[model samples]
Target: MTAVSLVDVASHLPPERVGREYFERYSRPDDPLLRNPMFRAPEYRRYAAREDTGADLVERAAAVLFERHGSDLAGEIDLLVTHNALPDVPFLGSGAEIARRLGCRPAQIVDLHNGHCAVFPYMLGLARSLMRDTGARTALLCTAQTAGRIFTQPGVRRSAHAAVPGDGAAVGLLRASGESPILATEVRHYPDHAPDVALKLDDGRLYWEPGTSEFDVAFDNSKAYNIIERGSEIVPEVVTRVCERIGATPKDIDLLVTNQPNRLLLRNWGAALGIEAPRHFDTFDSYGNLFGAGVPVNLDHALRAGRPAGGGLVVMAGFAGAGELAAAAAVRLPGPDRPATPTTGGPR
Candidate 1:
């Protein structure tokens, strides 16, 4: 039997760190958003240069993973999946370009558009199922969030949302080997909430309309409340459900990684799960919100800081938009020997 196992994770955060005050030129010190808990900015967050597109960040991150794993990994990938928050071009994904640049010709590629901020688990689950059915030996999954580009626009630079996110990309290598077997993956979608999130302009002009000014994300007070309420509820629920599938409780999770949009949500999630402060980790302060990329980037940061990703269990989870989608994935870290034990999920 073949089981998909996580090889390792790598991330590339643009080196330029911007402080909250950077938004002052566009906004104001007395701005109500400054005092709002959700909009309260972190001390500093990384940003990609204006010229840097989402594909650029993904390439750099994937390059780091390839360098660490050696050049041979480039040729071994038979499947590639990419989910970029701000793709370079409209109406197309960056999968083909990424695969081509990385020398993964003849690779089957997927450009996922729906999963949004908490898309990592969706990527993982899809990769596992595809590799299993196709008998593919290796797969590369990538996610990039270009907040630097989106927030810097004339339409949004002054808004509090501009200060709440960072720019970065992350990549994870999964192979048919079970050195660190994936225990389970689960996902749920809520189409009703999808419309709750949309673009906002100064006037009624549509995004593509000629008269449309720079647009920012906008929702009414009630919808905004629902988004927060739903996220707070669904994130922990999915994580707990994932734990149950593997015959473990939240206490068994040695490490928990999740999308870090704000400090409140991060705190609430751990408390609800009964997970200790030390057991759960987030990069909200350092990198801010990296969208769906947060899961892999945070995981990489934790592992590099010597957090134990091995010798125990780890779970990653998050919800996209208000609750348009939610997903969670669990993995059993290998012991010192890193055995090749199989999971029943592989191509049956």
Candidate 2:
């Protein structure tokens, strides 16, 4: 079978509504009562105001993707894939809505709601399969996250989820190709940690409960710890596997697009892996953690900032709701001669 490669990728954030200044002012000041500092960072607009919901982020991101590709809703898009945890509204799934807005037919849509690490790899696998079965020439893969809706709470002092979660969304276009720049992909799952990260139903509402005390006592105690504890191990392992399969290493990669859970986590993970942190592109400093959207959004930033030079590789990894871990690598295709412009505009 021919290896699959991502042909085009792009990302989007609501707008530059939140920034460092906002964080410094709002986040708790030395709240020693909780595991981590109380969400001191200024609350993101999506979380703070609730003006634009997760669905809104997805729509805006889809608009950005379409614009970047220089394609219209009427274009020849064969498949649409979206990775997300919190759908726009509780009742209707965001994937269907996104496809509708893009004018995609029902049969052409696929929704993967597997949380963090599983998203990228799952999407790659689905895209690969679609290419083989249907010979889909154009597939729109989008990951949209709205951390604000998930983490923030009323009168809750500090939350592990709050410390890192951010809001954002990203989209990518993939097509079957036999090319060097767009390389192969591999995926794996560690079922042992399945109970570590997850969302639980409480009074009919979904809440991110990173493994509770009872869960810790029952399962591997340490597994319930914050994502950082195992993140270092999981990320490098996946990266090594993907790189080894492709005959490349961290040094050869021009960009490392991982989940932007936290600045410190990214720094520590990069150092531990001996991979110079690829130009860290982040919306988390302002947006918070957009659960599934991290990788794709960052990839879009790297592309817009100026495509990395020859043989540039992008390593994307994430861990979300279900103690899930996902990682994939894509080489940058020769960029378009003309940079694409943003057709949709909003708060930024």
Identify the leading candidate in terms of TM-score.
Answer: 1
Residue 22, model 1: lDDT of 78
Those runs of model 1 whose alpha carbons end farther than 4 Å from true positions after fitting are 24-26, 29-34, 337-348
lDDT of 1 by residue, 32-76 (tens): 555556666767789898788888999999888876667778888
Writing each residue's lDDT as its tens digit, candidate 2 over 106-146 gives: 34787777546448655876677777787676677877766
Q: lDDT of each structure?
A: 0.82, 0.58
Clashes of each: 0, 16
TM-score of each candidate structure, all chains considered together: 0.93, 0.77
